[model samples]
Target chain A: MTANDYEIREYLPGDEESIVRCFNDVFTDGDDRFVGRDVESWRWSFTDNPAGWRVYVAVCDGRVVAQCAAQPLRMIVEGAEATFAQGVDSMTHPAHRRGLKRPGLFVNTANAFFDRYGGADRDVVHFGLPIEQAFKMGTTFLKYEVVRTQTVLGLAPVVPPDTWPAEVERLGAFDEQVRWLYDRCSGAFGASAIRDATFLEWRFSRPGATYVRLGVRDEQGILRGLAVYRRTHLVVDDVGCVCEWLVPPEEPEVAELLERGLRRLAHEDGATGLALVVPDWSPWFAWMQERGWRVHPSVYTMCSRHWVRRLTPLWLRNHWWYTLADTDLV
Target chain B: MNGRNEPQQESASAHGYALRSYESGDEAAVLETFNRVFAAIDPTFEPRDLRTWRWLFEGNPSGRRLWLAVTPEGRIVAQCAGIAQRMLIDGEPTFVSQSIDSMADPTFTQGLKRPGAFVRTCLGYWDAYSGSGPDRDAFVWGWPVETAWRIGKSQLKYEVVRTQGLLFATERTFAAGPAPGIDVAEVASFDEDVRELFDRVAPTSRCIAVRDAPQLTWRFLERPGFTYRIATARRAGRLVGLAVFRDGSFEGVPCGALCEWLIDPDVPEAGHALAHWAFACTLEAGRDELVVVLPDSRPWWMLMQSIGFRVRPTKYFPVARYFSKRHHPRWLWDHWYYTLADTDLV
Candidate 1:
């Protein structure tokens, strides 16, 4: 009808159904890359998030027309634990796409979300890998900064490791040992997601099909590195999809051992190649290239809003340790 | 007019901050201050590890001269690094220092704003390290983000050498005609052939990095984490031009990065051959876009523009300051050949 016909509000209990519809209509009902979503998936993404989820919606005549959500996450910023929010699943009804003007439904919902949860006391920092349209709107109107452009790294012909350097084993789930190793590695980074046992178990150990957990241990059986990956298909026929691979930045030997083991595992899984996503400034990026990985350009941009410059900056992509699983869409 | 300020020597201020040359044990404090300021500027800023720090500062072929601002208690509150590289300037390979890792503690900024403590620290370092003579770094230049650019241009008297933009291929297929008498092939390493090609090209090209075998090996080959593809163009079994590229992305779009291209300035045919090969290789890889960061003066920019690449809104301000009066302002932009790799941020 008109711009004034819609009202922006926080998500209530019964808003899930309308939110799911909007998500599907905006993401799936078009030529976008995302797959179709259902009510259950939506609930799992929003309600079941480990750090909790805060959502704002635009309701036009009692029907959700636009939605913006932030999933809270504990991050290690400069060796301190901080709250960072990953802005996810923003969508507007196709009927209202470009139909409304100045402070439109999309912007209204975003403004509400920012007003509610986008404060230093609340989330501290908010970031997302949004499409071009959202990126333009966020930077031009919402005061979001262009962080770093992301790219997909593909290594084809993942040659099997000739010799394993360390003890490699498949793990049932994350353990305290994993947390200890993660803590040691996480400190070297400027900004990274909290990969404690709780975060790992909650993230990878989802109910249906869980990720394949692999660990590399040293001579004294101390955990050196961990990798979470699964088999998937990309441009190549068979690809080993790496979700999250963590190794201490200072421990180059352990990192090399872990990479070799991961490559061996991928080859054993009948994968012709391996694929993963990394920020351009990732510490691991240079290593990936040194090992002959091919970096493919992606169609995604990491946009961010820094509510507190002291704790976090808009350019956190270089410090972020993100995998496909970090995204709710995965 | 933002005029240049001559270098001056200053000691530790009674105002709580002291100035000194960098010492061995000061790296940790310097890195801490660096991360604090840089992370606040761009959260994605990579925290420099000891190895990388050593590689950048300690392993510079010419040598290092780092200046820092420390507290009375000896904790480094600010750092300014001048990493040197050899570049062809006025037909001579001269040392040009890229001013990098410059940062001041946020708490100190209130008292250390422009023309204040930070500016004095920079001038102090410049006075001691930079000069026009054979013994000194000829000039100091850097690609500063907008905020730093303004400070340099407004207060520090840095000249804008060129304004660079991100250009993307507008069409899926790049339009080009085949070049006769030029052969292009992908090569595994840089050899004397490439070095000879560089010598043939460097004298005529402005502000071009001197790409000898050692520099080439260090820049592209010995790099631990990235793979670079090199395309060589030859005539009668002699190297005339070369193109260095890598597969990268911009805003999630596949980008063919034309990192560096050196062709014999005498042979215009080499540009067409190398450009054609670069476009064809990118297209063959199924890239969504081919991109390169170049100044408007480069002959290759004309070649890129001819083949559907259009300038986008993204801009990088290239600024520089000459230490010697003998330097001409126009030499910075005239006939210069640069790519993304030339920038320290990469």
Candidate 2:
């Protein structure tokens, strides 16, 4: 069919089956990572927020040959109100594959639909094409760098925690203190939420995972700092993992607290060393550096697509990883 | 360049119209309203980054559309857009569609004074187009909690779907000491005896099989990100254990990770051999730390601690669903092991 023979139009009321078939045909590979929802979830996107949705279809010889749709972005990151638009279930019927003129026709029609109903200038469009197709389209590939960090604790030859301050051992008693530190620090990275008591219990109190909560208290027994570490079972082997170590950002004795906690883990647990993961930009990095703890590099990439420049600062955008000891997820 | 200028005035007649195409003169006004709405929601967002503005005004054929809700004074209050051929979702038989970059002029929200109205308008656009029946099976991705909460559960149901894990590598160690039970020993290479040991253990283990030289090279040695070390353990001059390690990031920490540690389960000493060899290799490589991604249910935690590996909680979201069923196929996933240098390989 010639370009003139086809009309590009908004999706009408009766186009459901045609669209579904088109979707099935286009997504031939059974990979359903994102669109794996049942029909109910598919319908929910429409019924929930209809006004924010738009679809366009191309018709030729009384049959719909191609279609496209977009919706607003829901995640509000940083300070930008961003919209994410995806090109959905777009396809050309098999019979029309031989027709060379359809692509331009369909493109023009879909663009028109976007202009009329969807505000293009105000939305960010995110689309994926196969590596070959992306190369064919002259799209630029953006690079994201991943960073890793490792922590090493120096073990005292013979000193263990029992010989240290009583407050160091008492730090393991309160779970809330650990949560407070995680929320204040890890929350900034959009890491796992630690507000729920159940989540905290599941993370800290679970079997197999080792880490004892340690706290540094004032003379009044008020909790001022907290750290979590556990020595591997002597029978299991002798390494110790520092699950968490946090001092209030305002705490003046943060260094002392860290030292006290580390010495206790090393001396009491009979550990060879201690390791933890901290964000690259975290104060913990400087803290570890000042204490003369040996640091090593790790490998892992953290990447993100931003609608607006929000949490990704130029410096923090570099590589950073949490040590297995520092994170809640194994 | 299809540019046209028009005053920012909305006609009363245009208030409740269902769906209409954009007129030539509506471009700048639509863009202006969008910037205003976005600014209200996030002041830090630069107005120019919105690709919709450029696509609509600049006339790109990559399938972009902009629809608006016109006020009585001809002002655009709410708007939505559809871009063609964008993202792909995991399992759905549809190209991904996003319902984003929307803003309801707070003046309109306050004048109407009903939060529900803005939601209703947003829902109206989504329902009219994104629904399954007709022209497209587009799925919407990335709806944050605030948007989902505002629309109400009756209208929008939120699911905590899994995506890929974002790992960072850093240069600090968090383990308190050397893990217990791990015999720290050094080995030279994966010779024939070691290969036989690895092959014998492959059939019974859950680890990915690396029987042949090509498979071994491709899966372990060929990757460009990290330096690899091969170690083997022997008892009675017969190979009984093997550990393959690489330098990589765990979370963001610089460390070595035991990507593969296999011991003949039937041979009790094999475990010790493997652990000792691996640790010695890590130390020999001059890595101050190491991490292994273990299954949530694996007994490796004990093994890790025994050999000087500390437990650090890392976050990773690996989402998968079966194409034919509602439940995910559990077998497809591997408990990943990470180290400081490995992060760069991927």
Candidate 3:
């Protein structure tokens, strides 16, 4: 039969079992290169609708063949404004493939949908595809313009008690204040508006993370600075992940305090190094650069779909790197 | 966390509007106003039925609060909402206030043109009550890019996390190509032998796994607000492949989602049969739109293109972290097939 004999359509109510069968047939054995599957993920997919996201299917000749889906792009970027779409799971049944020509049908179908519903007035449709497909499709990679990479700095050797700062008489009081400050500013990234108290109770109180938090206070017991670090054994060796470090934007000696505090922790804990997540434009990065902190190779890219006029200049976009630890789930 | 003193109030005139707590009896008016507003934006927006409204206002255990800006005539022109919750920041205790579902009267759209004014009003409400502490942050989860741009200038910073793309099968180019070698079957029931074939092949598939009975039943048969269809392929009475789809909509666009498609790797031709079957099902159902969630990987894209699925330039940021760092490396799975609007995962 010719390809015209086939047709494409939507998934019906009873298709779940057959769909599962098709999935199992294609991926007969799970790849060991990846982590084990958590059934909860699948459960979540079937339920939970914070935003009204949707999915679609392709059928031909009364049989299920290819499928594609989309969801709302929820994050905000520093500048530029546009609604975004996340394209997920586009695949064809193996038996239906008539060579390289089949995948084009899928792409053509998706593009037609976008052109009809996306509205020409929209600024840009943003999504991440594989680097190879991106090249083939001629879609611009937002990371090239929006992302900033930096070499995260690790902690230095700790100084002895004799070398502690002269005004460090009230370190205990300082720690409390720093902790208090962190409680207030935790959800700046918009994942959740949960306040500091709940965050501390849930994350740090747990044991598996092996995190140690510290505070640098002034003589007046004001919380001027704070940092949270965790011990982790990387592929090569044990290191510290600086989950957080916050100082008042106005602090004059913030850099010196971070240096001394980190050094002391490293030496006391026998840590080989400490990896801190900082905004690309952080002053601590420059300080670390001067102090011989080695810069790693990978840079985390942040992209957003927003319709607002550029308020924060492009130059200031790299001012911060919110660490994974700062999020609620991590 | 100790409650701090309230923040200094900014001049209401500076914002060109007054912000206040939503009143109890304003629910109906607010919902009506929003429905009208969205209808102006897009006629297809589904209004909240009474049951859905009750769920939003009373059924939810999360103590969410709503605020609105009223016109001089007592009409609710603008509205915003917040959910009080806690999140971690740098391993410290933090409280966050999440904002969502801000809407304004279409007639006053010109007055609301100052995006910064609305944002300031919303944030001022938070700071005045919640206080800016280390852990206290304000969040907006799903603001459209245009809306984000209008108000993102002030204290709030915007980061784009996930994007959705759309595809339509307006033309059937696959019909011009050669046909598949295997037989594609459409069965009304998944029998024992079919189940056995599925179980045997599921453990090896990339996107489909053998789900527990509870999950299978709940996701497919038990879920409300969606119509699901399944199609399977068999060779010599042994199940070799299957594909699934859900009848749904996206923001009002009638569509069908290809939720899953799997075939034995040994019998690659089964993949083609599944795609052809799925496409025909979509057409028969009279749905014009189709969507899929694929990872930023190559092999899956190639498979999709080979069978008439077009790529919509979009990406989804599926945030995942290992529950325990010591357990195993984080694995990125490209398993999401097409999804339906009513599906909860989105």
Candidate 4:
């Protein structure tokens, strides 16, 4: 009930099961609309991830009450691979969600995470899609800055243009050709997730996943653009979600290919339309809106704690190349 | 707008540096020296390539005026530039220029020393160009860094108008759209309606940039690196007010930027309707928050506060050099309806 009632510390080995219960209790209430992930998926995300995870949990009377975590990732900073972390899975137990006017479980867990991972050696920057509550706590207590807000746009179901590039094709998995496309377009951004073979394979080609990979080739058959998407019913009833796209603004034809591919996939899936979250500064927002996409504002917010402010210019948030795949949600 | 202050004559003849107007061939040298000095002093500077330089210096609608200070050997050491801007004072279109991209070779001397190359070049240019008369800039203003602010204040006698506050508010704080019985429309082009809207709104605020179709086209549409959305409020088929905004992100968060807003002072509904339209557009764009920088005394500050904008901790200083007696320095903060877009940053 008071300041001395709880203590915050790193997540111990035995805390996984409690963390699962905590996640379900905080995020799910047996709601039919939302499916709560089990301990297996939690383990796969927090423990089995190749880049490793840094997690912090708050304990009161020796029971886990709140948690905050960061999933390690390799980010491209000035053309060099640098260590980064995506802040995610922040939750405070419902019973302990008190002191609405004062610091409590949320602040303590966030502070613990910041103390552990908010260092240059640990993370170049810790970024995540925070909710309203998390955003407040992060800014008020943990020195987090709102990087930008992500908006969800709904794409209307429409027939593909008759001139849909004939070069557009679907790939079973990511290949060197896809990597070349990513590398060629990567320079369009000053900072972003490192989409090398390892990261791309782990992201889009994982087992037990249903991601559709689309690509376009130039006359010589060199990969020019790529997109990875799947069907989702989160914001829109049933829509194709292009979570990641690899095309530069200079390459208008490449963007057209990716758009055509997503539309074709959505049409075949019998989905009403396509919905994707994009940062406001992304050129793709205007591109999609110009093509008659309806924008529906979502509640997602992105915040960051800079380990070294100068490592990357904060203005990278204004970049056009950032995609939803850069977040850990993908 | 040129600050109507008595011109302080300065001559580079006293110093070893020779001052001259920018010539066609001087572009490459001036640009190189600019990049070399700025890259060392400011980290945020993106090294200017030929294309960007040409666009900023040559493609500017109000042509650029650059004065350079060079050594006897013709090595460009210092440069001062006045980037011309078209603004409306009261109701008439007027030309103003921002003194920007000022730099001197650090290898020379530090601060405003007696034999000042930087001060002489900048001040000398101002002595020649600074005036409120018809031919000269209406008034000159700029947002200078702390060091430059001190130099301008102590050495050049520039008056500090107000320190700008960057404010933010969530979409929930604002109403959905225009006020009841007031109509709002998204303007696709700055046409006759925009000119009429400007005519109606110019008298409401003390100072404003005339939002005629041509000026609006050049400021918002023709400007590179940004995409702007223009909206207007109308009553009985007549334009009453207008707002300009764009979807932007702070860091990476979705946010909206209020660039310009104008309303007819006589018609109360116009201001309310235009503010509502801007807030609604930002909310509809899915921006969580909206940001604008203005002096706290402006009328919009109170109106926005009513709708839930709170001043953030950070502040930017806005200094003005008034060249016209018609525009009082003391009344600048309250009378003008300035927005973030009025500054060079937008």
What tens-digit string does per-residue lDDT give for candidate 1 at A1-330?
576788889999999998888887887775545566777777766777777888998888788888888878887777767787878788899888764677777887788888999776778788887655676576556766545444566777788887654476777767788778877876657877877777777777544544678887877878888887777644444678778778877777766776777798888788778887655455676567556565543445566788886533324644666766565433
What class would a CAPRI assessor give candidate 3's docking?
incorrect
**Taking the tens digit of each residue's C-alpha lDDT, what string does model 2 give over A1-330?**
576776778877666556665555655545443232233333433323322556677777667777655433332223333344433344556655555453454456556655655433444333222122322221112211111112233332424445566556544345455555545544344322232233334445544445676667668765566666666532124556666655655564754755666776566666766555555455665555455443332222222222333322122233222333323222
* Model 2 Cα shift for residue A174 (angstroms): 33
For candidate 3, lDDT tens digit of each residue in B19-84? 666556777777888778777776656776655554444443323456566654567657766543
Docking class of 2: incorrect
- The model with the greater TM-score, 1 or 2, is 1
Query: Which digits, one per residue and each the tens of the lDDT, describe model 4 over residues B190-212?
Result: 77777776666567666765556
Task: Note the Cα lDDT for every prediction shown.
Answer: 0.70, 0.45, 0.45, 0.68
Model 4 CAPRI quality = incorrect
Off by over 4 Å in 3: A1-330, B1-26, B43-48, B52-77, B81-100, B105-117, B120-140, B143-148, B152-155, B162-255, B259-277, B286-289, B294-303, B314-346
lDDT of 1 at A233: 48
lDDT of 1 by residue, B121-209 (tens): 78767876677754466778887876776567556656645444565563443665457988888888888777788888777665676
DockQ of 2: 0.02
Positional deviation of A165 in candidate 3, in angstroms? 75
lDDT of 1 at A201: 78
Candidate 4 per-residue C-alpha lDDT over A203-287 given as tens digits, one digit per residue, 9 for 90 to 100: 6643345788888877797778788888765555666777787876688878877888788778877878787766545566656
True contacts kept of 4: 0.00
RMSD values for the candidates in order, in angstroms, are 15.8, 22.4, 28.8, 15.2
Q: What TM value does chain B of candidate 2 have? A: 0.40
Instruction: Tell me, by lDDT, which candidate is best.
Output: 1
Give me the candidate number with maximum TM-score.
1
